[model samples]
Target: MKKIFGLLLVVLAVFAIASCVSEPAPKKDSPLDATVAYPPKILEHKGTAWGANPPAWLMEALKGYKFVERMADYQGKIVVIVEQDGESREGAELAASRLDAIPRISTLMGLRVKDTFAGAQVGDKDKIETYMERVVKVASETRFSGFMMEDSWWTYLQTYTPEGKADKRTYRVIQLWTMSKAALEKQLDSILKGEAANEPKTPEKERAIQAVQNAFYEGF
Candidate 1:
């Protein structure tokens, strides 16, 4: 009886040790669950803005790359920047594929900014300035010149309840502003040179410039 009791105690001790051994926490389905210093900011413009954390698979794919910054909701459109070290067409293609695997991400445009620019540290003033400077400097380099601004818009039907009655509304508006690195440089130069005022403008163009500025200075 004593030997049997000792055996049971040994088994319990083994179980206790097993329980104490920590396993890595399971990755969350949503990227929002992952801890980030600067959480995603609201993409303020018009219409309802919807944002969510990236999935576990995305997080894994983004590993070894520069960083998977927060996803933004620009008036119902989603935008994300996946920066990678060096310039690899193959790598970018693979990354694009990974991003496309996500349904929401696939719908929007993906801009690939290559080489030597790490995202600024959260709340670091000098780091932020340095990062932006580097981005601009890189932009100025003639070798990096695939920047273009795409003015693409789409409308969708939104259902809502008004006074207990179901109603549907169709929104017709330009929802996203995606700029290439070259285009971004041009806009930034225009803004810095006090030329944005001189250029013929629309509300959407103004917002796009502001959004790009904010993305650099404040992070997505």
Candidate 2:
């Protein structure tokens, strides 16, 4: 009886395997006739392949999302330059790219400048520049340009959006600026001089700043 039961189980397994193998696959669609829906249109343009998951045109303005520095012609003189995109305001995806790019450049500048500010003696404490973070932030907020010749220097950012699929909103800006090493030194000089000239007259200034800081911390 046990031998007969084992043979029956083997036969049932074979039947199940045969049934699976015999089941047909779904048929694929084939064109009924050689009919074209629309005219053949060019899928390539201006050195870029146009239709292969085409990127937003604003992205084309940047070579990549990394912080980039290069020497380029500035009023006929090659100069040290670092470029960052203004925070974009288009779709969240493109804006995220700009947001990512902005930090890399800002952090590079912030860390380098902060390093320069380090190791000053107690006498040089009067020359500390505190508004650099805020100043770098302002470059993202609005459109402006100047050639202050080393103070403001020849660096100027043009806030404009790349055409094609991007909205016409002014907030979608391309901020490209060139700064030479000489410009950085000149900027530092100006900051040192300005702070020295306007050193706070009273101790209350420090107390007031600390109070504001404490208030924010306590609130948090």
Best candidate, TM-score: 2
How many residue pairs collide in each prediction? 4, 1
For residue 177, what is the lDDT in candidate 1?
Answer: 25
lDDT of each: 0.31, 0.31
Off by over 4 Å in 2: 1-47, 50-112, 119-175, 200-220
TM-scores for all predictions: 0.21, 0.26
For candidate 1, write residues 1-220 as lDDT tens digits.
3322322232223223321222223344556655422211122212223322323323322331123222332222223322211133344334433432233222221123212223533233332333344444433432322322222222222223422232443322221223343444464454333533543466655654344455543332
